[model samples]
Target: MAMDEIIPPPEVDLPRETEDSERIIPSPDVEYLPRQTEDTERKLPSPEVDYLSRQNEDILEQKEEHGKTTELERKEKQLKEERHGEEHERPHEELGQGTKLETQCEEHKRLERQCEELERQRRKLERQGEELKRMKTITIVYEQFRQWIEDKASNSSSGVSFIEFNPSEVDDSVPKDQNHCLGRGGYGIVYKAKLRNETVAMKILNESSRQGEREFKQEIAILKRIRHQNLITLRGACSEKFALMYELLPNGTLEDRLINEKQRESFSWEERVRVATSICTALVFLHNAKPNPIAHGDLKPGNILFDDENICKLSDFGISRLLQQTNDTGTPNHITEVPKGSGPYMDPEFKNTGKLTPQSDVFALGIILLQLVTGQSATGLRKHIVDKLEGKKLEKMDTRKQKMILEKLQILDAQLKLDDTSIQDAVKMVSLGLRCSNSERKRRPSLEIEVWPEIESMNKSECLYGSDEVD
Candidate 1:
């Protein structure tokens, strides 16, 4: 063989075709792609990665944009969670504030109520303090009265005694006969009784009358301290039975005499004037009483008593009041929320103002004076006199006019026939009565200065006239 043929004939080793090797082979029709440049990376993003070579770039750009979008979404979710947490906490904080405000309002209401209760308690204490002071004054007055009674009993040399009797002894002395009963008053019955072997009058309080017992004690105290010829004399007293023994007056009360036709017929104008003067004197004594001035709250014909000699006396000091001295004017007065007195004789000023003064007694006396002179009912007597005297110039009138005025006044009592002097006296008394009963208290004349002087002058004139006639 030739040398070249001999070399070809020698065995050469060749690689075998496998699956991985077959995959590495490229088709002849496919185009080749190059790596991305820096300038191409900086250019605007393209669709589909600018074809094959741009495909790899497009994939890389998409992965980068997806990463950035995920980061932004995570941050937005975190922000949303924080806002939701704040929204949930806000309502609880507002509820806490509202509860605090309600509690404050309730506390304020409780404080206001407490303040009101304290104010009420303060007022109650003030009222109680006033009551206690009044009771203390009453106790002092009672002690003084008791001491006076004891002193009188110890100093007395007469057979009269101030011993308190038992109820059985008082009852045994009293007569049960209706004929023995002298009179019946608001508080008790007056009866003829035998006490200590002496005939005496007994005033026995009704069992139901608690006020009568107080009045009885008051009467005893007043009688023991005061002595008057015209006043009834207290003989003895039974405290246990609420009974009082007194010297009986046979003539009875002024009311009984005034109402009786026979007695009224015999009651002369001169006698009426005397009676009026006597009552005025008694009132003066009562008004000037020591320690305090007294006001007889009830003054009526029934409370005026007469002796067999026709002498008048005032009685029944049950409703009497002791006036206190005022600091501002040093005038004696009794100031109260309500004033008590008989309606017809009540002082106009005292009724309206609740202040009892000496003028109050003067007003009552005026009514009594008018009743004595005219023998008319006291209810409308003052007004009748006022109406008749309203426009008349009494001081300036002539004698004829004065006579006509007197006729028009209708003040003369139909039961009595009066003389010229008595008629003139009646006119004078009516004038004085009208003056005293003036609605304005300041206009009323003073009893000591004007009333008593006029009465005394009239009495003196009558006595002088009688003396001249006798001579």
Candidate 2:
């Protein structure tokens, strides 16, 4: 039954459904209207079916693109991880270098501080050492000086006629000379002698003569008491002979210098005035001396000398005397050699009274001033000059070299008379000298105030002597 049923209608051909369309059959018993020309009906597939197929293809492509993207992303992640590992390892290498730098910087800072501290300590130590050395030297010097003072104080007869023939440290190992006398005066002679490495003037006395011995002791006492720059330096002494060594002056006395024709060329007007100023300076120093004032009993050109530096120093102290507080108005500082000076420059009062004072020295210096200016010895000037009808020496003068000299002589004739007055020096210098040489001692000017200022003026404007004259 099953086979038969299966064969039936086996051959009945049915229209196959096509992919492009869906077919539908018409209703039965419909009017055969000329074999009902039902045109071959075709139905296209539905729009929904085409849309579904396009969507399926799009989904498949999306899946393939996603796989490729995932593969590429994984490869990128692996590469990044490898780079991160390398970067992580590099930090260790840099860390080692950084640690070394840090250690070096710390060490440098520590060393710098250490060096600075060491320098500070060194400076402190050096300063302390220097201070200690200075203290030790000062202590030793002070102790020695104190002991010397104490010894002097302890000796009762230390000062009174305590003629200590002390040797000079500078001349401790020197030999003395008997001859080679540099100068001779009433009291003594000055010998040029060697002392140690230096040349000195050794003033010796005739000790056999009683008068000379007395004077020698007096001079020694005076020299020991007085110390000044203007006075002669006392290197050492022997009180018995009244010998004293002095710093040697290369040049000789003012007298020897002024008169020597060849050497006189160097004695310019400035030098002459300078010499005069030095005399005044020495006089002032003596007059104002503390304890007792001193008077140079003899002030003369022969006693004044020039050093190697052409500096003036008062050489002869043999005639010098210390004047007490009372003004020695009655005495004169002239001619006697008993601490009394020379004749030509002596005050007339001194010719009678034998005493010394500041005024006495001033008077003598004034006379020397005249001798220096005239370049004529007192004997020559007296003989050459002549008084005329006008009662002045103008007629006797060959020419009027200066106006002050002529006028001064006229005035002196009216007062003291020209015959006795020695017309010497320039007009101004003569005037000053006359004032200094005044018989009335009180009328004399101070050495510093009166003499030095004028001498200084002349010194500053000095023209060579004879340059303005009839050379």
Candidate 3:
């Protein structure tokens, strides 16, 4: 059933190497009958064999192309791996750089902190150095002051006992001592304090004060030996920082009484006349002192003080000097340098000549007298006073003060027998002030010669009208 059905005959047969154009017909009865000749078999190959040869050639060519493609793929994969590795390494390098930058920033901040700490230390040290310098200066001044006092006390003929003062007792650092600062000037600061149940004024020279150390020593030397009722009494002294203690004048300065409305009422015209006279007497005592005559180089209302009793007293001898040598004629011995006095009270002749004399003091005293009567600033009204005395009307003077004094005199007239003497005395005193303040040095009157006696006479005339009575 199987062999005959399984094999099928070819539809067409191909022939090779036949030169004759002949056709061969096969009988269908036998189905498989043809036998190949040797020549034909040699020339023609079988179909399966031919197909296998072609397949082998195609397989060889495909294998060669595939090998070339595989090589290209391997090269591309290698390039990709290299690129990825480069990208990764680049980020790692950047991370390293970032770490280095952060470290640098932290180091800069540390340096800045260290610099600030050093600067603070430097400033603290500078302050400590300044304090040490101040303490050293105080020690030197105190030693000199103490030595001078001992010598003066031992040799003095006045039988005055010099009391040694402790610097710590009057030191401003003492919390119990209330230092109500009164005022400050070139000389130093003055403070009012209640010490030992007694009110007193303490002047303390600052380390940076404009007043010279020599001038402070000079003031101490002068005040320690000199004694006068008209001048301020020196209560005590502290060697530390050039501190001087005096009885407190609750009424403050003459300038204060003149300027302040409430305080000015306490000073009557008769009192001002008496004050001027007493101040002149003080000048006389200073000028005629034993051994060496002293000259008050600076005189102004600011340096004059009033007590609780309203008695005027001279103060601030910071620029006072004992005459180098006294002239026999009562004029203070001339010095080469211009006197150190307030500009308003400075004598013009003294400025021109650069010479200090008793006449210079006289000029300052006259200026003070003019201020007292006119109630105008010595500096501000210098030209006015000059003009008024030179044939100008009395109304042209400070009208406020003129009216005030005249009213006071009129009130006194109603209460007592104030005749022409009071008026004449006032006119004569004003005339004397003008003569004392004359521009020429020779024309200025000495307190001993002219100013003192005239003021004394005026005081005597004023006493008859009850000068002690407050208006």
Candidate 4:
């Protein structure tokens, strides 16, 4: 192609230049050309330079877009790594918390087991202590018995004779019949027998247990030393057979008379009062015995006896206790691990504390008084009388108030056929009975100080005025 065909022609017309406008001057080597006619063959400029310039601008724009895309991809990768790391650590924290909870539960269970073990140990210790106390009591009683037997053997004139008679001779002398059996007790059976050419009551032990032998020895020891009108007299003993001989009382036990309907009718109110007085006299004698005061641990109606004169004689020295002086102050401490007595006649304090005192016998006597006045069984008799007198209050009341209450009270047995004067005496006796049978030991009247005086005064008043006097 021609050079002219490759270049375009310039136009002749140009704009006038102003003062501030830029001026253009033609080069010395350049030539100006006229405009070509339309009919002439015109050459168009080549498009290669403009195309190359547009391609370079497009490449720069593409490079800038690629840099922006790379920055956004880098930020997204960092966020994903941070989220993955957090997810991995979350499980470890949850596992640690779960392990801590399991440890706490195990610790709580261990503490509960330890507490149960401690409670069991405490109960076992209490049982051991009770057993120790029982063993100590047995040892003491055995030593005292050994000393007594030795003294009796060494000194013939010890004021109390313990004769060891032949068992076959005593058995042959006594008759074996139900009629001859005066009474049957837990320890033995009593029979009217001829011993040493004298009519006597013989108690043959049913069993030769240690308890029976001890009771046999204790009875001989006590009865030989004591002699009273209202107490049974021991004649002799058979050691091999565990038999005791006593002066026969033909009237039998007070329990039989109290229970039999015909005998209860014949048992008059004055006789009942006299029986009470006789028992009180016996208790006073036994309680005031010189060496050591004695307490009839079991003083129920079954243990009380009557002679041909119908005088009340206390019996059954099996469970009786001698209040041995443990200290110089004479405060007797006769404590037994196991208490022996009738349930209805047992003193409340003695049952709880297992300590026997003369007041315990007085408690039984109070129950007997209640039985004499009401002719009722000893079971629940005290509560029945107290509830009637106090109207369910049962608290302590003044003497005047109690007397007034007793005057209006109507709890006496109708079978007794008590006259108005006898009823007054019964009321006074009931007052004294309630005072003696108080549940609290301190509230009970002293046998020597208060009980004996009041009973003796009643006996004297009855003898002087014949139940007609109120005071």
Name the top lDDT candidate.
4
Q: lDDT tens digits, residues 337-377, model 2?
A: 34345766775566565545678888888776655555546
Candidate 2, residue 1: Cα displacement in angstroms equals 99
Off by over 4 Å in 2: 1-179, 207-211, 327-339, 379-425, 461-471
lDDT per residue as tens, model 1, 1-471: 222332222343535777666565443222211212333346445555557667778888999998898888998898899888888887888888989999999999999999899989999987777555434333333343345457756876533545566788897988878999988877688898877777777888877654666677777777766655445667778887888887667787777767777888888877888777767666666666677777776777887888777778787766567788888876688887867777788998889999888888889888888888777778989888777778675545555565566666776666767666666677778878888888888899866556765664566323322233222
Stronger candidate by TM-score (1 vs 3):
1
For residues 374-467, what per-residue lDDT tens digits would candidate 4 score against the true structure? 7788899888888776653322554455445544565666567655556566777787788888888778876655565555555532332213
Which residues of candidate 3, in runs, are more than 4 Å off? 1-161, 172-179, 194-198, 326-330, 334-338, 392-420, 460-471
> Each model's RMSD to truth, in Å?
19.7, 26.6, 25.1, 16.1
User: In candidate 3, what are the lDDT values of residues 1-471, reduced to their tens digit?
Assistant: 223343565567556647653666454434443333343356567798789989998898889888888888998899999999999898999999999999999999999999999999889887676555434333322333344457656876523433446776676433444547877777787888655555678788877876867777787888888766567767777775577777777777888866776666556667777888767767766776668878788888888888887777788888888876655665556565645668878878778777777777888888777666656567756456555446634434454454445455331122222345555555555666777888888877656545665676677533312223311
Clashing pairs in 2: 332-350
For candidate 1, the TM-score is 0.60
Quality of model 1 by C-alpha lDDT:
0.72
- The alpha-carbon deviation from the true structure for residue 346 of candidate 4, after best TM-score superposition, in angstroms, is 1.2
Q: Candidate 1: deviation at residue 207, Å?
A: 3.6
Q: Please, what's the RMSD in Å of model 3?
A: 25.1
